[model samples]
Target: LLAAAERGDYAEYGGTSVTWAEMEAYFAQTTGFRRPLPWEPGEAADQIAGNIAWAEMNLDAAFEAARTTGWLDLDQYHQQRRLLIHQQLLRTAAFEMPAISTEEARAHYEAHLEDYALPFQFWMRHIFLSCYETHRVEEGETPTSIAEAIAGDRAAALEIRAMNHRRLVSGWDVPVDEIDERVGPLPAGFRLLVPGGPDRRAEVRARLAEIRESIHSEADFIAAARQFSEVEVRNRGEEIGPLPQRGEEFLPELEEIGRTLPIGEVSDIVETKHGFQLAMVTRRTGDQHRPFEDVRESIVSALRRERRNELMLDWMRGLLQGRGIAVDDVSSAEFAAADASSERVVARLQGEDPITLGELRANWEGLNAAQRARYAERPEEYLLAHLLFERTDVLDEIAEEESSAWMAPLLHIYDLVTVAEPFISHQIAEAAAQITEEDLLAQYGASPERYRQPARVSYDEIALRADPPSASPEEGVPDPTEMLMDQLAESLGSVNSLGAFRRVLAEYAIDLRAVTASPERSSQFRDVPLEAVPIEVRAHLASAEPNTVIGPFANQRLVRALWLISRTDDYLPPFEEMRSRVSLDVQAQRRSTLNTQWRSEALERERFELVRPDPLPAPSEATEP
Candidate 1:
């Protein structure tokens, strides 16, 4: 009664003189279908067919009223119907997206805190000096100590290089064919005439001297290197770093010094298994922890993705349940995954129809790789785990109905909605593509900090390890830290270049063997992060600049001196460079937030209901309302 009052159809019974011709014309105009006319020579239906003619008359009356008094202009009515169908389709996606709160995101972060920890990395540069160079000993001067022996060897090496320089510069104008014979076959790792080789050692030494002098006078090592060093890094101000902890590749002697080296200071020459080395500790960093602000965005995005999947699953379950779709737990049926084409029964559902392996396989191609994988990567087994709706032809089913004359017009309307619904995905793409260059830029602006690259430095280190004074702790030896410091200071005072540092180590009685004379960890430590082990070292590295000498720092029984090689600060690129990423992020964020609100409001307007099939019979088995 309420439904009749709502439609205002209670008064249609007045007069009641409607004829077959009138009803036939009305059905033709409204449903686009007509039956035999009263005066036409059509085959007369038997008495049984006449029994249902009144039913068509009643429904035709409804469609006619809707077309006229409902004031639906035929073309305008179809356009509006199409619009309504599209909106219904978009709502499905809109409901699936969900928004997460800050509190929720933070809770997730705390749970996964360890995942964000970055390793301890150090960006350092060093000048290496090998300890094995043969030095010239004075006639009748028997070496008394290790220092003397080393000094004699160092002097001899320098003298030989000086001779080589003289020959290369003025005297030995010998052709390439005679060069090796004259120099006694250039030593290993050496090539005559080529730059920074044996024949050019003297010039290399001289240039290093000039660079050292400039550094002592407070000139930048990177700047000096850009003007003087011979290695490939000279193009980059002689810097290398962003190195993490290392072993054999790094000289044992320079390790501690690199950790404690100041940000940008050049140090006096340091020596290793090789010869004299000039070093500058350009940069040092500790363990890295991405900032919470940057991490927050990612957490939110991840949570939303999870939320979307969960919501989609829940909605699909509800949709199916509403249509009396469910696996019949009582059935012993199972799909033969091994032979999917056999159309074997997988499970009986609440509906009388049982789901088959072939029916499930039909939709397999539409699933993504991950989705397909969920089915054990097999159509047969996958069907066991998932509940999916099989698509059907509503129009075909209606056409085949014995009651088609009565329900066909209503079915036409229903078919129109179902067919037009698929266009929604295209509509959604068009809507999403509304993202513009300006939108991407705006997105980038919102999370400018998230895009910043980690701080990195190209630096060189000068490591010098000094021995403790005493032989044994049982004998009341001096404090090892103190002894190591004194040794470093005394050596530091006498050295300015790699050559000078070797000479000083020889003078101070510091055994060349006791030092890790090679670049502490090679010439460059590549891209070391800012946070890591050894807090004192990290603090010193964070504060210094190019050419800065930070240490003489003492640790355990060893002492070290630091030099700065080079530094590279963290920075972000422009919006245009990362446009695609920015647009995706922006759209995702807006989708989540907007959909959160849209769903909450729209659900109030949604009309949904479920009818249990176990107790109620199919619609066709029951009478109409």
Candidate 2:
């Protein structure tokens, strides 16, 4: 049927041949199917015939509705009916997707909690102050230590204090944790002092009272903060969190201050190298292990997935049990007979067993190749038991242990999801297969403008590196001006043309390599170091043209470049060359059509049971009565 469609069989079945075969072929190509295969192993061809019948039923129904309801514009109605039938057919063949459950959602959620955990850091603001870099150089103390240099003399203490005083008014804020480790602990002298120092304690108290008045709203606090606070809060206000983990990531002084600050309240100015900051806790959430209530929706979602999986498995078991979709499980002995190539070694050692390759590799040889190489290099670091894989007894031991345990539940779940829903899977595959060769050609014909070649040009390069002092001792040797000028002149005269450039090296005792590039190629010489070439050669090549050569400017070594310009072969690929692309286009169009068809069919097949047609009173009636 698919082949017939690919040959445009459906085109003759209608008034104005709507190439359905082309549509199907497009689907197959887009999805990478060369041609459609027959339905699954046990499914009879009659089942495919029934699916086609369902597609026609939906298409006829849609066509009738369009005729009875004259509201549809002619061309649009035809297009819509085509799309509708395609969707309906897809769904009737059991292509409608199934829903996931809460159980599955929760399980997925639990597996990815790292995504939910807050970022492993917090925002912190701090002020910094330090002696000027120039002052350090002038002090002439390449210092035993920063502390010793600052504390050893009165002059040093004065410079340090002066630096801090200047920074009090100008320094910007920074994360305290980033401050120099050498600067032992934050000093108490860095704390904020009342304006007018000893005389204005009462005035400072009044300012704190005013700040308290606007603490109720973030907007009010920000406005008050900008006018009065000295901390470097940006124009938009401070964003100071995700606070780091409690015990591990904070300094003693910084931690104490952070932990003590109440929500919405500011702390007295804290100082670090950046200067001073009056910190505030804009928000705080206490650490509490989330309760089931908080995660119950997620858990329910997971439950639904698990339950759906269970239902799917049950469905698959029924199919395999009597529907002839799967063969019965064979005995272990029968299974063993199917694989006669493996040696059936019996262990001679008492209580020993033959080891399976999977078990041995899983328990031992599964180390990455590099690690395995290291292990092979030095066998001593690994456990003694892992090295016992050479013994045949390990297999029997694994077999005996296997008989005592049940398969893991997750494996059973996976098996069901895989085995169930064969019908839907089959339908999807059928829809995918409908795309064909003729369909591809039609699509390619429709859009000739889409496939064009890109512009291309060709060029070549010569690469040389400027020798460093260690690499070329001669490069470092200062040359006499007369000798240098004479060498430069000699190098410049080496290459006037391609033939002359090639032989110049033999005549002048200079070594050089030439490269050519065509526009069709990624020229290797583009990355060559021009500085390494003789200065005159570099300058000459810079101005040279296609099939032209100039050379012999001297800096380090001198060489000339020859280039060829090739016109790009920019043309659209032939149809056979672009068949795959056309196939893709066809497949996409088919799938979209099939999806619409499937939805339509599924909705028509669904049996809805509603007891009351007009359960609610109309708004107009309610208002009138």
Which segments of candidate 1 are over 4 A away from where they belong? 1-97, 118-220, 231-279, 327-625
**C-alpha positional error of residue 357 in candidate 1 after TM-score superposition, expressed in Å:** 9.2
| Off by more than 4 A, model 2 | 1-136, 139-147, 151-237, 245-259, 271-276, 287-301, 304-625
Model 2 lDDT per residue over 1-625, tens place = 3334334423222122323333333334334454543342123332332233334334444445446764235586435443433332222322223465556655656786554454333344322221123222222222123324434433333234333442222223422332223222433222211112222333444555555555655566665555454333243245655566565555555666666666555566454432334455555444434544577676666566556544543443342334222223223343323332443332123344543323433444457877666444223222222322233233234333442443222222222222222334445556876877778788888888777554343334332222111113356543322233344346445444445443322222211101110011112343344444445544554455655433222334222234423324346778999988777777777766776577456534642111112233436855755
lDDT of predicted model 2 = 0.40
Worst 10 residues of 2 by lDDT: 510-519
Q: Which candidate has the highest lDDT of all?
A: 1
